[model samples]
Target chain A: MNIVVCLKQILDPLAPAREFRVDNEKKEAVRGAASLVTNIFCENAIETALQTKEKLGAAKITALTFGAADAEDSLRKALAMKADAATHVMNDGATNPDPLAVAQVLTAAIQKLGAFDLVLTGRESGDWGVGQTGALLAELLNTPYVGFVDSIESADGKLKLKRQTDNGFELVEATPPLVVSITNDEHNVPRIPKTRDVMMSVRTPITKFTLEDLGVDVATIRAGGDYYAVADLSIPVKDVQCEFVTGDSLEQKVEQLAQRILEVTRAL
Target chain B: MNNVIICLFASAGFDRATQGVAGAGRRLADALGGQLHAIMLGAFTATDEAALAAIADHVSVATELADYQPETCLAALTQLCQPLAPRAVLLSNDTYSQELAPRLAFRLGGSAVADGVELISHSEHLQVKRAVYGGKAVATIALKRNPAVVWLRARAFEPAAPRDVTANVEPAALTLTTNSATRIVERKSESAGEARLEDAQIIVSGGRGLGGPEPFEDLKALAATINAQVAASRAACDAGWCPPTWQVGQTGKKVAPGLYLAVAISGASQHLAGMSDSKVVAAINTDADAPIFKHCRFGIVEDYKKVVPLLREKLAAARQ
Candidate 1:
């Protein structure tokens, strides 16, 4: 089996809320004190790919990404987690391309990489949280796509996928040449890379391609052409004024809090 | 006439979220001076039909759909929508619609936007307002293509008011080619009967500061007194103190309740993303400067352990 996992490098989502800043002119996040890391859901996808490979016993997994130079770190981490190869499609176009544009670039790269049985991506990027790229990629590739899959197992030359739904779960069976977007699950918690593997992964050479090399028109994607245009981008003003409920003792505070709760619930 | 189409899958019947989408569709249709059309897949109740009739000018039902097979539903919608050439295609932000919106847009030569909180119609195109940067920022995106496809966040808009005129109802001529390569083998649904967090008017959410799973029982007791649902922050879920389904955060589930009471949660940006749309927010945390305090309407700076039990007792007594 051949599996390709798409990873995205994003600013650490766990950063303090106050530290988050955005550059309105650029319509992008202002990278301040927060460091960049592989999107947590992308790590879940990588873990899913590794587990699928483990179950299949001989499947080869390739980690692919469309990002700037720093994104190589995410690929290297994927390598440490046992991805067989890494491909970096340098994004020299828009800093924040729309989902369709990203899917187009990834489709070009996947076609260049030849045949693949499976393509996996995180359910959504932690940064934009648009959650469209995977479905868009599947549409562009003309492949069947499944979203919110947490686990995959090989059975009778087919793959059994456990998909999370709003209500519960559905166990699905699919043949090869499929696209699946992985969601985080307890079973697919990302494994920590060993020191030896991390060192070795950093030393391993990664294949690199620019948009031009992949025959994608960077100018077209950067122009924001017929695709949706950003009409406005700004941080929403929160006008909430918190009134602290105070009392002399813990019991007194609880009593006051209970009164407030009653008032709120009564209004509801 | 220019028409706005609301695509709904009624596998579990038309839900409150679906009604909100229909309401949003009504707004769009009125803005565009167009008819509101509803295309429902799967079985629907008479109440669902009447609900659609209240808002929609035309209703099309495809009851042959057994389950939400993405490919088949995509095919059915693509086929149904080709002739309508809708001004905009609206859907609820559910798992099925999230998968369908983009592909259907691509197939119909349109553009798709997901999780829209607001939709505005113009002479030529539609603009959608959606949260980006994990709710820290909102971006207004203008759809430039035809049949602007958009999925709206649940509970973002009021349900459509009942109209005096009944809608013209018809069966949708759906051509479904099942993709034999992919099939659902088994399905499991969470046992129902408990109030869902999304529908709960009041929510009591905990976080890492709760220490462990034991406190959740107290939280549950407090919730039971007021018919509130229990939720947790990502930290609590990650620590294995609660089920992942109970998590309310950017990555978990977005909930907009009437009153949200957060206990011992430091209020990370991601957690705020899920509940910020709440009408009222209150927090109980020992930290005087927990980020949650800044966003909440009321706060108590005390250890939840000391406050929760007494508060539950008082609430139960008051309710009685």
Candidate 2:
């Protein structure tokens, strides 16, 4: 069995999230990058893949992603997590798509690769949480997909999925050659790479694919700017400082904090 | 006075903390001397028959969904609202409600406000108060009149409890159609944080400054220590430091917590626009001139690096 995961290298938010050029038309903070380190959702995807592979005992897990050259760092991280192989698509393409385009590109990539038993993606991207990619990808693949997933257990050649839906929780089961998006938050945190394993990940052989290689037109990809928008982004000009209420001493500070809480909540 | 319509996610099985809104809408309608109509779609969840009806003057349910589809749900709501011509169409901002709200107003060609908190000054320009700037400040929004529609973030308001002796069950018979473009073929669940941000009493948010995903550990530690939930600004989520589900801004989640703490965040107007209405906001930033300071009742002009760790330590020590 073969499982494929879709990922994108984003700007690390910790670095100078602010970068501007003479051409102001393109001044987005580092494209939501810092989230690359086994993001909660991605880790869940990897975990799901690993679990399914374990169930099959001889299954293979492949990491697939597209992004800047630095995105290779994330690919290496995936290798450290014990994925059988990795694929990085580094080329000029839409940094963000209308989710549909993303699905299309991912679908095209899947077709290019040999058929797989399962295709996995994070329930939602760290940057844009439309929860669209997985659903759209599944729609394009004409396969079944599950979302808001916290855990997965396999048996009898069937994968059982649990969903954290709007109201609460529900469960679904599906066969192989299906699409499953992993959910994240608190339930399942991604495992950190050990120092020894981390060093070895960089040495793993990684396959590189481009839009041309995938036999897909880059024009078909939608620009991130068009799919959604950040209309007015700016720092507020106002300044509202703390109104200290005589918390001169430690005990006094606690008391004053309590008093302020009352004032803020209008309990006073 | 105008008629009231409490558009519910009863079909979606009630989302987030929509129970609060259902309860609150009943109270608001009672206060305004209007008929409180509880619109339950799909099947009823509440076991007590009388308890459900006490909140509203009347109860309506739509069922046999054919299947759970968004377009089908929206079309059902449009048909329901067309004949009623309600003064305000209230909705809960769930995964489906968020999509349903704008379309409901659009299908009716009426103006609507999403993520509304309180119906402040509803005469003429039905103004509402919402949280913004990471729950630091509150802003007033005036809804365009006639048939005003509003979508409140989940848990924004409390559901009305039934005050009457019993609920009068009225089943709605309607042919609901759906768009074939989408379907829910699979769903899976993962272990999640303590409480959904919308339901938490305390929220801790991080901005672009935390540096990386690992630092979220510190924030998460602080939240665990204080029994608080974690949230993030659009900038942080946009930069990939955090997931969009945790984002707090105009384009993200709107939270009105009892206490909102923002670390390393330079309060961008867009981020603040979604959280400004938080009851008490505390901002910790290195930049004293950061816009977040203006809305905070407690400003710690120090590096979040030192502040977050120290805060975690202090909170832990105090708890111990």
Candidate 3:
């Protein structure tokens, strides 16, 4: 079995603050010192794919990404964590493209890579958290797919899938060559990297795929693209002013904090 | 029974809002001339069943020895759905539902749509409404077939209140003829948030006018005194002061809490799209012309730093 983990690098939700300098420039996020992959949900996808590879014995793991130049880090991050190989589809300055086009672009890369038994991605990316790319990709491919996976079981060449919902959980099953998406919550805590492994993984060969390589259609990618539109990005202005909490004592400060939380809870 | 099987995800442990979302689904089902059939796959406990059955009509539960394994539950649903195929499926747009809605749709051979806001049915086909393009446009989705699974973003729609119907509970076991290769080596929950942003009923949000993230503390203090969640405009969230979950806008959580207290949040269309529908909005900002002031039922054109602290002081006094 061959497994592919689809990844999208995003502006870290907690990225450091940067001023938006131009009409086209997206609002800069605070990097917060460390650049992380998209939403944590993708980690679950990678974890599930790697686990399946281990079980299959003769399976290989392929890590794939499509984003701006900075997003190469996401591919590197996937490598450091343990993807057998990594590919980054570079579209300069396309840090945030329409998600549908992004998925379509990635699917083109998948087509180039040829056959795989399974494909996986996180439920949503963090920056936008639209959660549309995976389902949309499955639609484009017309493949059997499942997401919000809690667990997957296979036996006798049959597969079972469990999906997480709001009130409780749900279950579904499908055959091979299926696409699955998982959110971080459904699975357990992700793996931590050994220092030696992280260093080596980042250094490993990460193939770079581009518009020419993945065959991005001019109609679908540029302005007046089939799926999305580009608009100006604006940074919101800021003003900070506040009166200090004037608690007479430390105990009083604690009481003030509790009172504040209680007040917020009670406003309902 | 024209049942709409509203499935939810039961993770390793229980979430406080699961019951609330279930209760809301029950109300929605009842209003639509349908019954809410809640389903669960987990290591069942007495407490779990009790909470689940409270909001569902027929609770089909499959208990597992392991923590709600994905493969086991998927296999179980494949079997269970065959016996209990419903008109439509509703799940929260949380991580689990987002994943399952499509997979379940694939297994049942039905059309699946995610992040639906409204479910309108005509002639056995359902027309689902969902936000597209990051809240830029509302798309009406036509369900391709029967039993189409539609996942609604949690907190987007209001869960109806519970009715007086008695919930029926049954024990189910998945005929898991397969074993999954993925084993959870370790599972960790995100840092426990003091406030469940999805569940909060009262929100106090700041905006670019707050100057810096520093003044958000005043809004936080004010909100805490009133028992409210802290929210932000896109500018604030994008500024990296508040998390995205705390953003109330078209692209963010559409909140209708009883009272939404706005401190310095300018209501942009994108931002207003989320909060404009709130039950009652009260905004305190220095700019009277601020867009948020127009949508708000009560508007106070004053410095938030002054008014927020005063409001906090009043609430604190009233509680005592």
Candidate 4:
């Protein structure tokens, strides 16, 4: 079996809130001081593919990403964790592409990879959380797609998937050559690479493809400057006032907290 | 003939959450001075028609679907919008809409903006207000194409109040093609009868400060006293203290409830992205400097074990 897991490098979603700044003039995030890291959920997607390979022996996994050249770091991490190959869809790092453009570039890159039994992506990117790539990729590829998949198993030459919904979980089945957007579940947390393997992963080869190579124009895949305009970006003002209860004892603090909650909720 | 369409996903009947989408769609359509219409695909009953009639001028119901399938739903919505030449299309920012909105935009050759909190008319163009940089900043976006598809954030708008109005309920003309790539085989509940985190009026969430899963039992007890739902931070979820489905953060489900109570949570920005829109927030933590204090309206510096039981007791006594 062959699987392709789409990985993305994003400013750490776990970065301290104070570290995030936006350039309103440019209408994009200001990444001057922050470091980039693999998106948390994309790692889960890679783990999902790896776990599938573990259960069904003799599998090849490819880590694919569409971002700046620096994204090779994310692919190396995937390779370190056991992906057999890596591909980077190169993009200019200056502009932040919208979800649609990202999906289009990914679609083109996937077409360049020839054939694969499965394609996986994070349910949503950490930064935008638009949650559209997998769906648009499926549409562009003209294949079946499912989102928010937590569990996957192979049965009778088909894929059995468990999707998380607000009410509960749903069981879905599909054939090969499909796309799935994965969300992190207890069973699919990414494995930490061994120190020796991490060291060796840097020497692994990564194939690079540009937008031109994929038959997509750089300008067509970018957002905000011409296609749409970001009128403004600013810090939102919080309307509520936080009242810190001045209670020396634990019980007093608890009581005061409860009383204030009731007073505000008009429950008493 | 309405020039604005709101696609609703309903099975058996229109879900209450879809009403919120209808409210947002109506607001945008009204602001644009365009006719409002609704499109739905699933088991549609008369009750669903009546509910939609109160909200939209016309309702298109596709009764051929046995389940909510994004591909088929997109096909139906695309067919419905083609003839209307709609100015905008609205969908609820649920799992289904999250999947369908972008694809629908692509199919229609338009642009999309997801998880928008507010919609307004700015200089004759529709602008969307959305949170960026983990809820720390807001960006107002304008689209350049027609029939712009948008996923309105849940609970961000007032659900349109029901009124007495008769609307035409016509069968939608959509040719849904079956895709061999995927199909849903079965569905089972994770925790039956528990309040859904997205729909709950009040939420009681725990964090790593709880130490283990056993405290969630106590947390659930307090949740029961107030008719609130139980949630956990990403830390608790990642530490295997609770199911990831119960996690509320940037990676988890976004919720905007009437009141949110964070117990032992440090208020990371990822967690704030999911619940900052909550009408009122209160936090209980041993650390006074937890970032959650800055975003919440109330705070108590104490261990959750000591505070939770007392809060339950006080709330119970006040109710009685």
Q: Identify the leading candidate in terms of lDDT.
A: 1
The native-contact fractions of the candidates, in order shown, are 0.82, 0.14, 0.06, 0.75
Q: Give the docking tier of candidate 2.
A: incorrect
Candidate 4 residues B1-320, lDDT tens each?
22788887665245445677888887777777887888876646767678788889888877775477655666767887888888889987677777778778878877788888888764645788888767878888787766678888777777887768767888888788866567777878776766456767788999989999999999888888777889999999889888777988787878887789999999989889988988788999889889999888888877888888888988888778
> By lDDT, is 1 or 4 better?
1
- Alpha-carbon deviation at B194 in model 2, angstroms: 12
Instruction: Name the regions of candidate 3 deviating beyond 4 angstroms.
Output: A1-109, A112-130, A136-268, B10-35, B43-55, B65-72, B133-137, B155-165, B177-186, B190-195, B233-255, B269-277
CA lDDT of A62 in candidate 1?
A: 90
Give me the runs in candidate 2 sitting further than 4 Å from their true place. Answer: A14-24, A30-38, A165-170, A185-188, A193-205, A212-217, A220-232, A235-238, A248-252, B1-8, B11-40, B43-60, B65-254, B258-279, B282-295, B299-320
**Runs in model 4 lying further than 4 Å from the true structure:** A222-229, A247-252, B11-16, B43-49
- In Å, residue B226's CA in model 1 sits off its true spot by 2.2
lDDT score of residue A200 within candidate 1: 93
Instruction: In model 1, state the lDDT of residue A149.
Output: 96
Candidate 1: lDDT of B305? Answer: 86
Quote the lDDT for B95 in model 3. Answer: 49
Provide the TM-score for each candidate, comma-separated: 0.96, 0.58, 0.58, 0.93
Check candidate 1 and list the clashing pairs.
Answer: none
C-alpha lDDT of all candidate models, in order: 0.86, 0.63, 0.62, 0.81
Cα lDDT of model 1 by residue, B1-320, tens digit: 46899988776466667778888999888988888889988757888888788789999888876577777778889999889989899987677888889899999999999888888876467899988777888888989888899988777777889899999788988777888767778878663655445656789999999999999999999999998989999989989998877888888878778789999999888898898888889999999889998889888998898888888989999987
User: Candidate 3, residues A1-268: lDDT per residue as tens digits?
Assistant: 7778898775444432232122224423334454555556677777777666666666778988876777677777777778888888777544456555676787898888888777888866554555666766675666656666746666677566655443334555566676777754324345776788789986798788777776678455643233323322333332322222336664454344444445445554
DockQ of 2: 0.08
Q: What is the Cα-based lDDT of residue B185 in candidate 1?
A: 80
Q: Between prediction 2 and prediction 3, which has the larger DockQ?
A: 2
- Candidate 3 differs from the real structure by a C-alpha RMSD in angstroms, to one decimal, of 10.6
